[model samples]
Target: MNSIDKELLIKMYMNMVKIRRFEEKANELFLNGEIPGFVHLYIGEEAIATGVMFNLNTDDYITSTHRGHGHTISKGAELKPMMAEIMGKKTGYCHGKGGSMHIADFKVGMLGANGVVGGGFAIATGAALAAKLRGSKQVAVCFFGDGASNRGTFHESLNMASAWRLPVIFVCENNQYASTTPYRTTTSVENIADRAIGYSIPGVVANGNDVFDVYEVAKAAVERAREGGGPTLIEAKTYRIKGHFVGDPEMYRTKEEVNEHFENDDPIKNFKSQVLRRGELTDEEMDDIDKRVADEIKEAVEYGRKSPYPEPEEIYDDLYV
Candidate 1:
């Protein structure tokens, strides 16, 4: 904590709060039928995105999963456009075509969020290869879930990145479940990071709920990638407090378990307590941030509501094929 700057700490805290508030508002809007598509809420995994993105430059690339709003926001995306994207408006990143899951901002190096499970691995790996081929120091981070660890793309991309020494980081948000099934039931390995050994890359684990821990681990990995030390596999252990989608039945898990994690393992709540206890930030400052974030979210909602929808004549406007 002493090694980290005070401003960076506050910024990380602010981003985390923004992600939490944004997701909560999105959930409410989805329930109210304002959003058009499936919404995968990143309610419990704020710290991982905030911590990791803090170490990156604006040009650094990232490929996100279905649950990607937190990643997009942390990567310097504005709230108004992001909210508009979720609401399927013309002012969105995708002009209302890619609602909820497929938002992209090439200006910020966020390759489009993938709706396919494990879809980001190859995209991130390829982006890293592009940087390497161009003799640039840019690095790419791939954010996926525990379920994606079992996919063929996960193995193939890692093998290729390790063999060629691509500057990439594979971050597995091990949020316990892969949709309706627990990863424990489907995955053979005890830890997702352990698979990195097969590709001869460093495998590490971090407490995803702890912003400090995630920042430290990601900083080391990013530094290594920049210095030509090859790729890293990071498994950020976290839990998904919400259902797989906005309105999932969630019959597999108990309400008691969910309630326990929400009470004890919520990253935002834990972050506020830790910072205040260490005298790193005052309650007044945090409260100010909270009020500002609430106002920002409210404004974003209004912007999304006011933004126009795409016209019927433009169905193929941005299509490539």
Candidate 2:
């Protein structure tokens, strides 16, 4: 933890807070009928995105999962554009076409959040290949969930990445559930990182709730990839505090089980505790960060609301190259 600078530590904390607040606000908007599509909230998994993405440069590429707001925010995407995209406004990243699961900012190297499970594996791999071909030191990161690890694309991507020594990092956000399915029931291995062994790549697991822990693991992996050391599969063992999607009946898990995670295993709470314990940030500073994040989200929502919708004919605009 001492290896990370104080400014970066605070930035990571602030980014986590931003992601939490943004997801909460998105949940509110969805329930209020302001947002049109289903939203997969990244409420409890903010630390994984914050920690991992903080290690990346703007030129580095990242492919996101369906629940990707945190990834986008952590990668330095603007909140107004993200909120606008969720609201299907013309000012969005995709001019209102790419909705909740598909917002992208190529300038910031966010390839796009995929609605399809395991969709980002190939994209990230291809980006890594391109970077290698271009003689660029850029690395590509693919963020996926436990469910995605079961997909065929995951194996294929890992094989190719390992064979070529591609500059890629495969981050498995093992939130313990694949939609409503518990990871234990569907996953054969005790940890998803174990699967990376088959491909002869380094596999590491980190306490996803602890930002420092995640940062430490990701920093090494990212550094390895940058140095042409090939891909690393990082299994971030965290919990998804929210339902699979907004308005989910959540009959798969018991109320008591959910309550326990919410009460004790919250990532943000754990992160704040770690920071405070280390005397890195005072309570007053944490409170200020929270306040600023709330204000930013408020402004983002307002900006989304005020933005115009695309014209009917505009749908065909970005269709061609």
Give the alpha-carbon lDDT of every model: 0.94, 0.93
Off by over 4 Å in 1: none
| Model 2, residue pairs in steric clash | none
Candidate 1: 10-residue stretch with minimal lDDT: 1-10
Q: How do the residues 1-321 of candidate 1 rate in per-residue lDDT, one tens digit apiece?
A: 876878987898899999999999999999999998899999999999998999999999999999999999999999999999999999999898888799889999999899999999999999999999998999999999999999999999999999999999999999999988999999999899999899999999999998889999999999999989999999999999999999999999999999999899899888889988988889899899899999999999999999999899989796785
Say which candidate scores most in lDDT.
1
TM-score of predicted structure 1:
0.99
Position 256, candidate 1: lDDT: 100
Minimal lDDT window, size 10, model 2: 1-10
